[model samples]
Target: MAAKPVILQNKACTATYTTRGGALVDFRLQPGGINPLQFRHREKSKGSKEVFFNGHFVCLGNWGDPSAGEATRGHVKHGDFNRLQWLSSQKERQALLSAYSTLEGLYMERNVALDENAAVLQVTETVQNLHTVGRLYNLVQHPTIAAPFLDGETIVDCNATKGFDYAFPQFSENICKTWPCANAFDGETINLSSPDRAYSSVFSFLVNPADEWGWVTAYSPAQQTLLGYVWRRSDYPWISHWLHFEGELIRYRGLEFGTTGLHKPINEIWGKGLVSLLGESTCRFIDTGDTHHRSYLSFLHPLPKGFQGVKQVEVKDNVLVLTEKNTDHTIKISHQFKTKYAIQQ
Candidate 1:
């Protein structure tokens, strides 16, 4: 059976989710406007093979490819979560989706709630071990942002100490820990926040040891709007910067936040002293009937013109604060829920 799409909305936004893999296909502002998220980066596929190029999807079980010819062992690229089906239901401003992946021996459930007349999306998710033995898993939220919302004048603001190129060994093996500063393969100092500094595409991490919480904000001065995400570091210790660009033909960045820091499979990441890049390790040993929970929140707020960048963003006393990086401009928003991560290890 074809997995039907589920829609949830409030006054400020509308979200669409697919029962297959529980991917959020669309999230846009109301009453009607373009999706803040980009989609269909390429033409249709010619076969049954799937592409991770969708607007937004979740990666699980395995962050990357499985071991060679291990399909019989339920190994699939990025996990079967995106390849499996989920059961869904909704009530008013909230929606619930749940599924069981026999391949991964895990059951996952997600609840999304949109507050009335608010521009916030609260997401809560739980993962349970259904198998008698333990298993290693990787989970990431892949939200790629692109045009009419992305431009060279756009700015990325976040607090991270060091950065490492994910795939380019020439750069990864040598880049400095000065953060957002990297020596390209050609000895050029590239600014990680610049959308135009891409070199053959790369995967990188915003390495941090924050146990309280973490956040990253993207400001589109062109649209006079800002988008951001807040999560707990104990649940997700790393934020990944995915850069890909080739002139006007393609340019998109994945402000990815998730469990594992390394984008490789379990074998490459498990017990390999890869924690520096693997972000806190999504590798967990769960016996039968054990459950784990992780949650995060996303928001889209309008910004004033000429807002170049942000210097600080913190959820203090349930108030979201944004202090401009180079000026005296500041924006504060009061909300109901705290930005703190609910479940702490």
Candidate 2:
């Protein structure tokens, strides 16, 4: 039988999570509508996506592909959290899932909760090292957005001030640029919000993190809905903005936040110390039996009519306030997750 999912619902939204990989499969906003989070390649492709790549998955100990040298050290792309069937249970409006990945040498416990009357779901995941020797690691929250919700007119915003593109030896040279607007391969500066078939670029925002929090937002003008995320800048000070639009059935964008300066393997990130994440190394050094933790909040808000995009977002007194870019319209979200807390499982 397929691994069953635990359902968490409220008056405004419902979330479904599968035990396989403990992946969040669906997060529907309001009553009856499609989920903003897209599934991977359900639209008839030539090749198969063997690993379950849907919705959002926690990347523990690593994020992207590991270097050849690092691969010899037992590194896998996106870590090993998505390869295990997590054990799950629930209480009231919250669900708890736990699992241990021998490949990643870590045990993780996660807790997900939905607000009683708002389209907000909060998740907290903690990964503890189970190794006999110290290892280099990193953590990232990978949330991919796709069509029906992400369109040409959709606007992406964040607190990033200045950044540059990645200059891989195989790819083109990267240039330093500002946020939201950067030069694409076609030699024309394009807004990150707009989609282009010829655009193939990765913008790494050197996040000028807030004193306590950092944020990213996406507004679908066509859908009149806004998605927002807030997290600690100290824990994850780098944000990667990946945009691709090559084919109809294979295009998607990612608003990835993590503890690394770039989406590279520990080989490129460690001792060389090419970049620093909030005054620390991009690669983390975890001793045996030690634990690492972080917390974040994601909300799907039904916006007022004519809402173009967001100007500012901040947490105040257990409330999330979103200020409109060109108007006085502001959305406030009040919930337990407005304030950070440790994960309980």
Candidate 3:
């Protein structure tokens, strides 16, 4: 039998994490509000099959399709963490879960803690290589949002810079394009910040090298609510925008940020050697017995009447300040993270 899901609650929010894949199955504002992270249970039949992409699950070891040899060997897409069970325990408003990836020889531990006075969740993940040899790995936070909260009017905001379409034959900087303006599969340019566009594609953008922080937000005008995430730029330098629609209607949107943006295999990313153009390593390296840590926060803010989308998000004195677009209004939320990986002042 599978273990029970862990529930963490505070005065401002309630979060539920399932041990099945250590996925954040549900997160909602206090007093019964609509949960925006409702994306769950979709069958993925490619490579090793039987895997499902669910709500807010971490893509460990890798991001996309494995090499042909790796796939033939029964390797799953986006790593085995999402397809395997995890050990979990919770105390009060915090939950701790751990899972080991046999294929990657890496052990990952995650700590999910909720703020007592705000609808904020701080997630810290640490991975240690248990193998005897050094290896390259990628970790992506895949927080997908779906309907009831996601629609044609939803607006996405971020600080991403130059980016490229994933359909490109190779990951090259020569084809890099500015953010919010990307080439659709139909050979037309469209603004990627809105879900109303008539295209289904993926785009990746690099963070400004000088910026210490990176953030991505999605606001639902009709719902009068917004969901956002913030992380250290040094930790997660790339954000991938995935838009899926059906017959002029939006279906799902993925606000993914992580160590790697390229969705190819290890051989394709490292063997191709495009670090000079990326200005950063496309894959992270970990030696035996060494551990790597990353931290990020997801929060929900109640939007006021006549409020616009997010124009800017900043971390100011342990608080998350969001400024509205085309307006001077700003919303502040408590964002004090109790972890060593917290962003420094």
Candidate with the greatest TM-score versus the true structure = 3
Residue 317 shift from truth in candidate 2, angstroms: 1.7
Candidate 3 whole-model C-alpha lDDT, 0 to 1? 0.82
Q: How close is every model to the real structure, measured as TM-score?
A: 0.87, 0.88, 0.94
| Candidate 1 clashing pairs, residues 3+ apart or interchain | 261-278, 262-278
Runs off by more than 4 Å, candidate 2: 41-50, 69-75, 167-174, 185-187, 195-197, 247-250, 275-280, 338-345
lDDT per residue, candidate 3, 289-310, as tens digits?
8888888889988775577788
Q: Which candidate has the highest lDDT of all?
A: 3
The pairs that clash in candidate 3 are none
> What digit string (tens of lDDT, one per residue) describes model 1 on residues 261-328?
56676776654666445234545555678788888777778776788777767767766787887785
Better of 1 and 3 by lDDT: 3
Better of 1 and 2 by lDDT: 2
| lDDT score at residue 28, model 3, on the 0-100 scale | 81
| Prediction-by-prediction clash tally | 2, 0, 0
lDDT of 3 at 304: 58
> How do these models rank on TM-score, best leading?
3, 2, 1
Q: Candidate 1: worst 10 consecutive residues by lDDT?
A: 42-51
